[model samples]
Target: MTCPLLKEDLIFNLTQGLGYEERSLALYEEFLTMLEGKELSAEEIHDKEIIERIASDERRHITIAKRLIVIAEEYYHTT
Candidate 1:
């Protein structure tokens, strides 16, 4: 049987990573908004694109983390 404590630890780590990704999403979203119409240097423009990519990646990470947490909870209960 799977260890209950191990499941808890996995869930906790997933939750923590989820939180960080959420925060990243929020920050990037805000940064993207702040980049509106105003002119930007070439580097800043490049950064905006990078931020957009990171934000999208973080969103996916959050989704995966949430799914993993649910799976972990189910296993935790069954074990």
Candidate 2:
């Protein structure tokens, strides 16, 4: 038998993490849009690169969270 409380907690946490990552990804995309067509200094360019990398990571995190949620749901339902 699956523990209802643990399953609920896992789903909730995964949902929250997904929301956070999505919001962060949106903000990063907006910032990148704002940077478009602007001449950047070397440091600014480096910072932008870092931001892009982080945004990529956020996207990965979102995917992982979604997958986990699905797996958790399926596991709980089956068990």
Candidate 3:
């Protein structure tokens, strides 16, 4: 039998990671907005590119987290 405690812990960790990713995504989006319509130096432009990449990663993480949560919940109930 699957351990309910393990499942609960997994869900908790997943939830935490999901929240962190969401917050990170929001901050990155806000940073991008702040950069919009502004003249950026070469270094600033590079930083923006990096931020964009990180933001994309965060979005991917969020999607994965959501799917995992659903799967975990299903397993939790079925066991």
Candidate 4:
């Protein structure tokens, strides 16, 4: 059976360079773990507020990966 999470286009784009789907999957899995453990600080949740350094660091990698998929689909026709 295929893993539903692995089927996402974002996961596909991130893993393309690595050539190992498991690497991307592992990154997102860790991201999910971080998100599950807490509510963001009031300051961190606002669009105009500067995100805390620690919180930004925690989310940056996955956000980059997700952006890659959007870029691919929107500009490169990867999908």
TM-scores for all predictions: 0.83, 0.91, 0.88, 0.30
Q: lDDT of all predictions, in order shown?
A: 0.89, 0.94, 0.94, 0.51
Top model number, TM-score: 2
At residue 20, what lDDT does model 4 achieve? Answer: 40
**Clashes per candidate, residues 3 or more apart or on different chains:** 0, 0, 0, 0
**Candidate 2 regions with alpha-carbon error over 4 angstroms:** 1-5
Query: Could you tell me the TM-score of candidate 4?
Result: 0.30
**Residue 33 lDDT in candidate 4:** 62
Rank all candidate structures by their lDDT, best first, as comma-separated numbers: 3, 2, 1, 4
Find the 10 residues in a row with the least total lDDT in model 3.
1-10
1 or 4: which has the higher lDDT? 1
Clashing pairs in 4: none
lDDT of 3 by residue, 1-79 (tens): 6654788799999999999999999999999999999999999999999999999999999999999999999998897
How well is each residue in 45-67 modelled by candidate 4, as lDDT tens digits?
55223323434553565566566
Q: Which parts of model 3 are misplaced by more than 4 Å?
A: 1-4
Instruction: Judging by TM-score, tell me the better candidate of 3 and 4.
Output: 3
